[model samples]
Target chain A: MSEQAGYVPVVGAVAEPQPAPEKSYRFSEQAIQELEEILTHYPDKKSAILPALWIAQREYDGYLPPQAIQEVADRLERPFVEVEGVATFYTMYNLRKRGRHHLEVCTCLTCAVMGAYEVVHHLEKRLGVKVGQTTSDGEFTLSEVECLNYCGAATVVQVGDKYFGNITKENVDELIETLRNSNEFTPADLANAIVRLHIPERTAKK
Target chain B: MAETLVLLKHRDVPGIENIDIYEQHGGYAGLKKALAMERDAVINEIKTSGLRGRGGAGFPAWIKWSGIPKDTKKPHYVLCNADEGEPGTFKDRELMLKLPHMVIEGMIIAAYATQSAKGYIYIRGEFVESARSIRRAIDQAYKKGYLGKSICGKEGFDFDLYIHMGAGSYECGEESALMSSLMGERGQPRLKFPHAPLPIHEGVWQSPTLINNVETYAAASQILAHGGAWYATMGTENSKGTKIISVSGHVKKPGNYEVELGYPVLDMIELAGGVTGGKLKAVIPGGSSVPIIPAELCKDFKLDYDAHQVVQYSMRTMRLPVVGSGGFMVFNDKTDIVVLMRRTAEFYTHESCGKCTPCREGTRWIFKILSRITTGGGLPGDIDLLVNICDQIDGRSYCGLGDAAAWPIMGAIKHFRHEFEYWIEHKRSPVGEDCLPPAPEPLNPLLTLTPV
Candidate 1:
């Protein structure tokens, strides 16, 4: 069942071979400053791994390639395999490349009963791709997610940082069109929002 | 009874998320009251209120609050479990989004009572909007001196709160696993008491820590603000205070409703504009982890910790529903019990952290068997096999996730055995053509080519 429906890689999948560490670090100076400030929030640099990976996801543009994982390990002074283990254990951290917009429809129990599958089938038809595949233009990637926890708005479709709720097969096309023209809710933006949350406003303002 | 507005009282107020508006609406009054009292006095207030943990366990709040060592040599930490990943729950999401200050104020009060120097709100990563609201509130609190060193001019009372974002792991909602995730490890459960010391003694960084659900902390703030005795006036003898029920699924008015504990289950259904589409069928009174109650049994139940216990005693069965985390999900007559249980099984399978053998391997097997049955490959023994699998996984697992995965399936089979038998004998859903969760497509294309 997971072979077809599961879009995110199963957690704790064996780590792929790491790219050579010779590539220069890609994190900009501001990103470095943000990481340094985040370090102060926790006692050890190791606790900063989750936030560092979020920054890596942002810096690497959407998904964490091997180079991005290496950059995070190098920055935190941890083992590459150790960082990869943490990254792979989480479903939100995309291991492979994704389209500019990742459409995650909640197909958990409440959403399922409320016609979440119809929404999924509609998106597949509109995008001309199956559940886990990206559109031809690399604009949209469709996948069924576990409960986004907004079940009151069943059939909640998460587009990056934003959650479009009360969606159905009928209104999903309007949402897709809106997402097609907007770039604010990309995977990078999702990572950026999570990263900024860790840094206190007092520190961020300065 | 009607919806009682306590935590959500000022939820719809304009600019309530801001410090100024929140302060004007009697915000931080609880912190002021708590700061004036002795540390033990603050705990005494909570004890008076009889408030239990709203994070599903229903453990008494005062026991955990007073559990922290008074003369601890190590630094104490207060952690808020804001990762609301329960399938049918979104109350914490709304609380954090609308009443961020209330949650923060409660955390501050907890830090004061526990004498903790540091705290963290480990929110799930999908809740970026909620996290943003909390971020703004925390910044405002720091600016107003509600947080940081010498809070509100109290000497030797310094508290620092930080936001730790989880990367989409439901297992982190478990307390020990939450600490594991906070320290940047795999979000897996640790051995519990009798096997290991409780988290209050040796927790994150080997320090005494106090962890409470988002609703628990928010209720703490309210309990402190109004004296515990005043707060105790509502609810049943054992259960006190109002609980925010996240009503969804086949309900006409699906949203978060903060109703007092001991409210009738049937009344709650009506409160949410009654069930939509058809007659009421079943209700998962708690989150998906608890047992699913057939509509006939739901009438006598009340929304409280002890009421659920009464249900178990009357039925003479251990597998009964509870008011768990207040994720009230109502289903209509058109819903198919077998199909709903299949989706429920799939959720637990996807979320099992693989920390223990019983949960990791068992959840997969359960899903596999259910999928097979749903796809028209059910053996006559499949029903008993599913029960056997549930029994093995129930008490044997490391944490509650295994039990959570087993209970609903067990509950479904207990109440709707006929549905399972019909499916096995007829090779079709008993609900017929319009059944929800529509039948699963066969995993193999060739199987679809052949007729049932």
Candidate 2:
């Protein structure tokens, strides 16, 4: 059954303060265009929910607030509950405020055996916060995540969207310092790393 | 004892990622072969190859394609399950990253076999590089007339292919959940047995959808070009062709290695340059879901569908031999069994979709107990309680995730009960005596785009 996407404004029963209707969330023109193009790939507009949430999260500063979720649901012509259900099911979507940089350490079996726990302990001790807490300055949030699927490079860590594999206590400290000073790690750096690691000298064929 | 590189063949060739280079290296030869044949003949060719689903289930691929009703009025959809989130399994990601078109070529041929007009490559969201690579390949395929209207310039063979990015859900690797996610719903798995319709009969907006993992599609592409009979000549009985094992964890060289089925587990370890420390202590032959095998028991083990043999124990009835998704993880003696189990429990706990009761509640309960035990709060009967809880989750949960969550706990308890006992008795982890060296920093973690 197709769900209707019509909006219903909530008039708070015990309101301290409420935003005006004009303050409703909307994606930037570029994002909306990106979403529109994404919609063309799917037979049903609903299939674009995951990517739509990605666009919304990137636009709304690394987390899907209620407004962002509702805006996505409204724009995609899907029900809010459906959008929320999809959002909550995935681990990547931050429901609440995360830090400027979120460090997700892969603590699954491969990474764990490769000393992922030590990295977690090191980060927690270094950052003065537990696994899921952000620093007081709102700069970092440390989380132990399930497999990031880069098993060849065990003990992988993701800062924003960039992935650093074979992470150790030393590298973790370096990565934290780099993220602290820089707002973004350029894609060029990541691309160069992938090419270098993946392209080794020709070897004997199996 | 040599590695067999069927799927990874020519994968390391410079510029092989490009369609033109890919074609020059005999890439689209499979699709050309498939398109030239009668559709059923193509399916029969795959059937003859004896290729099983490389996604972990080991189900025969051709039979799965042929299961869809031949005369259904609704359009069939082929889904390429590139959601490679299973812990320790990065074969699909590497396959796609190195050979995106090979995977695409597999999907194109699979689409032809199933008579599907539209296909979706559902890649995991974290693979930013792979998603871009596959997108480029799809565009190139369209330009070269291998996809879209009148595929390969055959007048009536029209097919449309699109890439759908998954927003990080391990459960989406389950076929039913994958279809549900593709339909824009939460990626929780729908009930499969007893009542719910199979994806082949009623999937994705109630249309017959054929979904196969990326490795399966890549294998299928090869099978088409080489012919089923030729492909069948590789492996042992039942488990045909070469399997790519994503070997990681406590090994000297951890990476994806392709070997013919029935290759000895000991040889695989040797191929990986052996254990990191002393000798191997244990092995999680499949992904983290299957039970771990003690190194002693691994002596006669082979890398095949039914290679693992459960040792005799009173609780052995629950254990089954599994080659789940080919995520082979080796562990050395220095590894802490309790901590490993704790991490395993935490993973299922964090990933449990909360759809059904047992998995939701059971996983959390186990995780909490594990957390307590690892932190020195373990009680006397905590082992029994953990085992009992795992039994409950394993027996009645909605999907395979429940069984997966149950397996490692049972395996650890069965094999390494002393480790748990030491933790409970001494109020400390047994691993305190054997400190592992810090992991080596990745040589190159990021990859820049190579111009096509």
Candidate 1 error regions (>4 Å) = A1-22, B309-321, B437-452
Candidate 1 lDDT by residue in tens digits, B161-280: 999999988999999999999998889989889898899999998889999999999999999999999889989898998999999999999999999999888999999999999899
**Alpha carbon lDDT at B10, candidate 2:** 87
Best by TM-score: 1
| Chain B only, TM-score of each candidate | 0.95, 0.94
lDDT (CA) per prediction: 0.88, 0.80
- Highest lDDT: which candidate? 1
DockQ, every prediction: 0.41, 0.31
Tens-place lDDT digits, model 2, residues B272-349? 989987678889888888788889988778888876545233364664555778899999988888878877886787
Across A1-206, the per-residue lDDT of candidate 1 in tens digits comes to 34766467667786876557676689988899999999998889899999999999999988898889899999999998889899999999989878899998888889988999888877877898877778889999887788899999997989899999999999999998888888564989999989999888778844
- Model 2: residue B254 alpha-carbon error in angstroms: 1.0
